[model samples]
Target: MGASSNEAEEINDWELPNGEENKKIEEPQETTEVCARMDALGKLSSLIRNWEQNDVLTAVAVVGAVTTMAMAYSCF
Candidate 1:
């Protein structure tokens, strides 16, 4: 005894019977952090914001990058 052909065709219903397939992913409440990295990033953000207010931070950043690059090339 086997399922009739009609029973096989009915299994192809387009939706799950109660919308179970439409569920969304939920955000997790906890996350891992590196305290040192977080602190450095916070300080950097503060410096940028202070620069925005005082108007010399961008120039300082450019100088800082040039200085770092010069030092790196000198080392090699």
Candidate 2:
């Protein structure tokens, strides 16, 4: 069904009263920045993925042991 006049007017108000031209200009730049971010994140993730699970677990255990030892020594 066709929009009633009030509904049509409300829809028009929901559309940008201004800045449509600016958004059209910025869209490509926004997309490019997002893609660059995604690429960097993928590279970072791959670096982390290169670490073996055993290595990560051992590192975590070492840190935890160090923290526990420090806390115990501080109790003196």
Candidate 3:
């Protein structure tokens, strides 16, 4: 009974200190921003890669028009 009684108190007090708790909980702000930028850049990069893969980027005229459309879409 005595050993069993101590278990609840011990478990109740088991906690990482406040600083460590904050360190664990409050991370990922910079990581989140970096990941978002990486995602946007990856999307644009993949589009370029696809254009190249399909023999689309070889033409300067089409490249110009596509880039203009991209710029307009992104701005709006």
Candidate 4:
């Protein structure tokens, strides 16, 4: 289910009208800034996930310790 050779040739031969091609292209600095922002967002998301996991684990440990202490005291 792909385009025929003649159709592909026709598509490849297409061109933008007048001076529109120059307007469509992005500046290199803008592209780099976008990429850097994406990377920073990715890193921030990862850090938050890890911090949440650590907090959950810490809570579980505290609960377990409290339960153990209560059981020990009840044995008196």
Candidate 5:
């Protein structure tokens, strides 16, 4: 004989429970903080934080972006 309907339903319940099918599973806040720290380790937030404390570095960044874009467009 072929598989019955209840067996198929049981298989789906084994994969995901009844009420949680439509709900999104979320991690706790402590896990979120740990993941954020791990993800940001190699980023340049330290430099950005220093630029926030100093105005000269921000101005240099803006000027560098404009000069680089100008040189790039000139070559095309």
Candidate 6:
């Protein structure tokens, strides 16, 4: 079964039920760390929090490409 035109349009727009619009909640910004190492660690933590599956796939692709290049170079 296929969705009707109205239903398809709603899905594309990501509209909520009852014609409600999405709202963004403001978050408090974090204070900057005085120490460089602490700031780096904080950024790393943030990266971990926002990590996604695509990042893992890209890392794997990089490793595979490097390995292939090394193997090809060794044949010279």
Deviation in Å, model 5, residue 33 alpha carbon: 61
lDDT on C-alpha atoms for all candidate structures: 0.75, 0.83, 0.74, 0.82, 0.75, 0.83
Error of 4 at 68 (Å): 0.2
Per residue, candidate 2 scores C-alpha lDDT tens digits across 19-73 of: 4522334443468889999999999999889999998999999999999999999
Against the true structure, whose TM-score is highest?
2
Worst 10 residues of 3 by lDDT: 19-28
Q: Residue 13 in model 6: shift from native, Å? A: 72
Clashing pairs for model 2 are none
Candidate 4 clashes between residue pairs 3 or more apart in a chain or in different chains: none
Writing each residue's lDDT as its tens digit, candidate 1 over 1-76 gives 9978888766553446785554457996543467677888999998877665347866888899999999999999
Stretches of candidate 6 exceeding 4 Å from the true structure: 1-34
Model 2 error, position 42 (Å)? 5.5
In model 3, state the lDDT of residue 31: 79
Candidate 6 pairs with clashing backbones: none
lDDT of 4 by residue, 1-76 (tens): 8999999987776667763333355665668889999999999898777777779799899999999999999998
lDDT of 3: 0.74
lDDT of 6 by residue, 1-76 (tens): 8999998877676646878666567997655654766889899999877978999789899999999999999999
What are the clashing pairs of model 5?
none
Query: What TM-score against the true fold does each predicted structure earn?
Result: 0.30, 0.44, 0.32, 0.33, 0.30, 0.41
Quote the positional error of residue 51 for candidate 5 in Å. 11
| Candidate 5's TM-score | 0.30
Candidate 4 at residue 11, lDDT? 72
